[model samples]
Target chain A: MSAEAQTCPALDAKELDRLRGLCRQARIDLLRSIANAGAGHTGGAMSLVEIVTALYFRVMRVDPARPDWPERDRFILSKGHSSPGLYAALAARGYFPKERLSEFDVAGGMLQGHPDMLKTPGIDMSTGSLGQGLSVGIGMALAGRLKGLNVRVFVLAGDGEMQEGQVWEAAMYAGFHKVSRLVLIVDCNSIQLTGRTDETLSLAPLAGKLEAFGWRCVECDGHDLADLVPALERAVAVEDGPVCVIARTEKGHGVSFIANRVEWHAKAPTPEQLAQAIAELEGAK
Target chain B: MAETGLTYTVYDADHMTQAEIYGAVLTRLGGERPDIVALTADLAKSTKIGKFGEKYPERFFNVGIAEQNLFGVGAGLALAGFTPFISTFAVFTSLRAAEQVRTDICYQKLNCKIIATHSGVSFGQAGTTHHCTEDISVMRSFAGMTVIVPADGIETAKAVAACCDWEGPVYIRIGRGFEPRCYENDQYDFQIGKSIQMADGSDLTVIACGPSVQHAVEAAKVLKAEAGLSVRVLNMHTIKPIDKDAIISAVHDTRRIITAEDHSTIGGLGTSVAEVIAETGKSCLLRKLGIPDQFAIVGYPDDLYNHYKIDADGIIEAANAIMGTELEADEDWEDEF
Candidate 1:
């Protein structure tokens, strides 16, 4: 149990509406930053907007002022290439000035193409190479427990990145060890770098496989904040074993032409496309 | 032994291997520091890191058979503000999980120590898969990595304690079992990036690392007695941030240099010394004795050391060859490529 685990408070209608507003803006900001950088992982970052927003805004107990707080809940973007998504959330959450978002992958800039904990203030762990973040979260979780600190560690990984063998290695260790303070959110955004993940390497029975590996598995629509917030809270409540919330999402989630487009995996959106994306998000309530 | 600053150990120093001393030393340090943690990849017994596990089971993590996860978890533990000591075979730590070591630990500049046992061809009978002659090459290339090859169990103890205080990523490569001791005890100062002059002379210098230091010292003694040759033996334990001053001084004092190592002739102690010589533009005749660019054959470690000319007898032969050679005075370059 955590210091903040007294209650899984339900999200009020106004709160949900406000959070949805942040997620929509997060998508717009992340896309603009990617477009500004001239090269970035557009699709994956777009897919992760709500998941990252939910943690920074509602779920996790973190402070933008004290990024080094020992008792703060930790977050790791294991899908590090989707740094723009994380940066947007950090900016929206006031970790740093939102204007710094323009420098997203610029040479000599504070924000790197991947999440670097040393460089970025709010980043808990440096990650770019796939399949390393979960193990790092396990380390943080285990350390917190060892220190008797009531902290939680949340790791958001991509479906395509699951192809990496190291992911399962960490999964097995956490599951076997019953590290309950960790929550793994798999953003099942189907599309990978080349094509659909199912076409490339199917993890069709993904939930069953995770259950077999000894984790408490939960599934939900990653884009729906109401569903996702409750799923995350439920995951946080489980004290018996590690929890894996398989969040079904779509690559390039918000925009019309970019959604599920494989080429947008790492491609920068053109100026016209950015305008369209901004309009689509802003035009919504 | 009391003068060495290390407490008296129950384990017999003469009979025990470097890995055993490392395990004992780590177990002792775990008592002093609460932040210290140990990890292994199903090599707890083989690497002898299990000793620390037995002492502090709560701090120990056995990431069974997953070399990548072992390093990744070690990096993670390091991120959580605990100093993690990870152990595995030299081949796995330096080669199998190279990307994890490089990207996760070295690139991030994490305070994680890698105690890689069974380095070089020490596990000879285990075949080429277990043999790691390329570790020095691979580990030295990674940025922010400190590499050390202790000569014996005493030096291993000193190195293990020293690294606990040194920040950033460090790689300590040691042999599997019973390689003869080079030092009597840990009385001598063991500093990272500094070479220890075992026996001093001016005729020729033998720059060696790991178990090769013992062979070099013995060879120097034999060369002094029989051939009437004055030989200098330097235990170049640190590979990364190598002792450039020592190598440069050896070149200035003794114009002939013979580097011995239980690794490849390409990029171990031999190649590191060669880079120094090339950079200095000095006129020292250099000879490298090691495994001559091939997969080491299966045999006992001692037999393999002899077969590959990385033993005492091999150093004697190489010393003789260097003593008989003359340096070319001409500095004109030729494009051999």
Candidate 2:
């Protein structure tokens, strides 16, 4: 039997706590990975840490040994700049050796600036150009439905990236097709590369827009596990059409100096800043 | 006047158009290749890919009116390991979704087959926006793209079957509805880059692709009977890795060449053939027959083809014009070179 199967029956509460601890370590690892690179998207990476943790740890039916398993659930980081967080989560989940984290953005490293499906382990699609990933995810889901495979497809989109026209096209398609097996998580960090989303282009009443597009829109504090777990469960429970989880999150949630700041959108922390950030995260525990 | 009932040989019928055969073969191929997914951008019945779509509803994707997203989604599906055949009018697929095709499929080098229909003046009555006169030039310009403009429906089927084994990006252009069939049967093999010689002669050569290949062959017959012109005809289907050897030989032997295509004279077959001829410095008379620099006038496909002088008469006229030029004698050629 597998390690997860062997440990599933016993220690239910303990396992959940351990998973949360794993998420925390992933957050720390993300900060370090970005700090080492010296040029990475820190804010959005930090914002998506908990959700990435939850999926890799508790929800996703993945086998690191069998990455290409036909029935495996696919996760697409549509908001691809948050590679540091995804790499950290993947490492924690044992998709690759944790030591590979040090090679992030190094020359000849498997980790590129954006997710390359060919280079990285467990990456389903190479996504960096905004608004293209959801379409890919929908195709995967459609393929699964056609093949009668019970695999689910998950795509995480940044609120800023949602401004792209193709995203809405994908949304309308997913909704119209009633792709029940697909889940879209919008990392509503409110900040983009330029400035705030409202300042860049007003996407206010975002949930209403998604609802009008025929998705079951779920709103929750992205960082809060209480709200997140239930919202995710509800999304999975839906039988018809796609589900959209509007995850309201701070651009940088864990660190005090960087939290809610637009400057940290893709800026890496200095050595002192990294130390300060680690200390703040440790204090939260 | 004697009543003559001339019998055309089976070999003559064998050269039916590829566009008609593409529809029939795709439908049959759909029955066998379950994983072969089909997509259209609201031009299903018009492009004739609807035959395959109707046969295999579960495998077909009609994404409505979005051409850009059609290619993007097709790339995505190809990335997921599904063999996706995206069909639409040539103008939209080549020009409208040109960037998406470049970045998503060609740049990434995905295994997506773009079956662009209504190419050239095939959609003559639909006016300039719908006619795909520039598709060949546009598709040929992209790196790592296999561009094929099959002569008829029979050739289309052969091209479609051939593209299945091709391991990278492919752009196959077919004519609009009721295009004259050009191939003989399923027995004929279709290679991506190889040119098919339709007729052999020594006086002048006519190189053509797509619907114009038939015209070139017809023109060869007319030239032989009326003006005693020995014309060689070549169906230059594959434009990208154009049969350079055939062109070089044509220049060496015939010395007069006319390139006919249902496209712009600028970057299509004319330019492709010119590039080859210029490199060899062969003393050859060359004339390009295609849509002029101006926008095409609105009419039926056949009328438009005639209006643009891309028909058999046009090819014959071009051949005559080039044949009128004196061949450079060996005495004068050596000094010029």
Candidate 3:
């Protein structure tokens, strides 16, 4: 919480393991919230557990109590159906009570089915529709550069979300304007709501597309924070345009039956299914 | 103030393009306030923010031909403590960037200003796609939104200056060309939600906004001079948080009311005035004049206004039609008053 604490980014192996453990617990909480609400997106939430967890717990310089801290790094969940995942990370970081996870999608609760910055704390921009957050981040990054503020914007988007044409519009802006202090992390989970991403609309050679758009690309294991943290460091070090970290991951990472399954994109677990999934996660632990 | 090519001050604002006035004001604001910034979605030349772009090159951003991103990035800029003035065509902001304007700016209550140009049939030759008649409806529907349709160059300057420092999202719709001035000068007080009564007449009231305000004033003058009818004209520029007292005064004093705009008759100024007058349980014969249910006819803005009977002549005719059917409100509506 001091100036020295803000300067520190080196995570010991033990801290990394503890963060990983926190991610595992967040994943369980994501499932519990979705299951408790009786209907929600499970696959994308599970896919985003580690990347989001790493950003909140270790990467982003955000204090929960001061979510509006001007110097704090910003995060936007562009793929907003996965609110349970983002809520889990914000909860684990003490932005709100972890008990609020059970209230996901409950009418009149803090957690909506989608991310609403007005209703929920620690949500930088209220993003539900896809392909818009990157441009918003570009705006913030440009403002930060203009103000000479020690801040950066991180936008987490999905491969399916990239299908929207606005994403490329923002990419072109970021490239042409030479906006720095911004990182765009694409959750390259190979699946979407109705079908696999490649089957729906191919983003093959996504890195090449990003490169053409003037972004420096770094591919990493989305579920492995070790790969993500170092790649994020490289992204931060780049001084030119924005950086893109293409995180390769399955549709559902933690649980087996839901892994790479398109149908689980928005289906919640029953009580029995929750028990079975908890057993599988416990077994893996 | 900063090399504005015009000698027009607030006391003598005459014959300047509204967009030029906006550019001049922004150029001045950019010099005075470092937090003020300009953005356009490749409409710098057409929307007239190009002047500001040229003056303060570092403070202006052209995000290519993308309106949605223009709005989203405006919210982002506002979030990072900058006053972002995003300019584009009104059609794009109302339809293309509607979601971004709603979710990103209005929902979050960001301090962003949207300068939507070429509103209404002002882009008549460009056809319905370019013309924006639904912006007033869409912008007014959002809560915490300050919707302003400046009547002329003077009002546009005032509105731009007022919105640069005011909190929350503000959408100011302006026309393509020079609308005839409704005010002799910019000395009038420009508030966010208050109506400006240009003239007071007890026989009838004609409430209009944007391009229609000048015509309504011209009609009021003609009716007073030619027909011996006292037709009051109101420049109801701010649509959301509309002046209820003004409408009630119009209803109480003049039982005949006619609302006109350069927008759809359904959800724009006409409907807003009707709702206000109806809520008071007061009886008034009202003529809601604007573009009907069909798409606008292709022509110049003046020709289209005449064709749709919302021009000065048309407003005069509408006033004549409504003045005949005024019901007596002497003592029957005393309790409602």
Best by lDDT: 1
Q: Compose the digit string of candidate 1's lDDT tens values, residues B42-105.
A: 9999999999999999999998998888888888778879999999999999988999999889
Q: What is the C-alpha DockQ of each candidate? A: 0.73, 0.42, 0.81
lDDT (Cα atoms) of all candidates against the true structure = 0.89, 0.81, 0.87
Q: How far is candidate 1 from the true structure (C-alpha RMSD, Å)?
A: 3.3
The reply for model 2, stretches above 4 Å from the true place, is: A1-38, A98-109, A268-285, B1-20, B76-80, B141-143, B181-187, B202-204, B225-229, B251-257, B271-287, B292-294, B321-337
Give the poorly placed runs of model 1, Cα more than 4 Å off: A1-10, B1-11, B328-337
Instruction: Report the C-alpha lDDT of model 2 over B82-116, residue by residue, as the tens digit.
Output: 88888888999989889878767886678988988
RMSD of each: 3.3, 5.7, 2.3
Candidates in order, TM-scores: namely: 0.96, 0.86, 0.96
Across the candidates, what are chain A's individual TM-scores? 0.96, 0.95, 0.97
Return the TM-score for candidate 1, rounded to 2 decimals.
0.96
> What is the overall TM-score of model 3 with all chains considered together?
0.96
Q: Put down candidate 3 lDDT per residue, A165-235, tens digits, no spaces.
A: 99998998897777888899999999988898999999989999988988889999998888887787778
Pairs in clash, predicted candidate 1: none
Q: Cα lDDT for residue A221, model 3?
A: 92
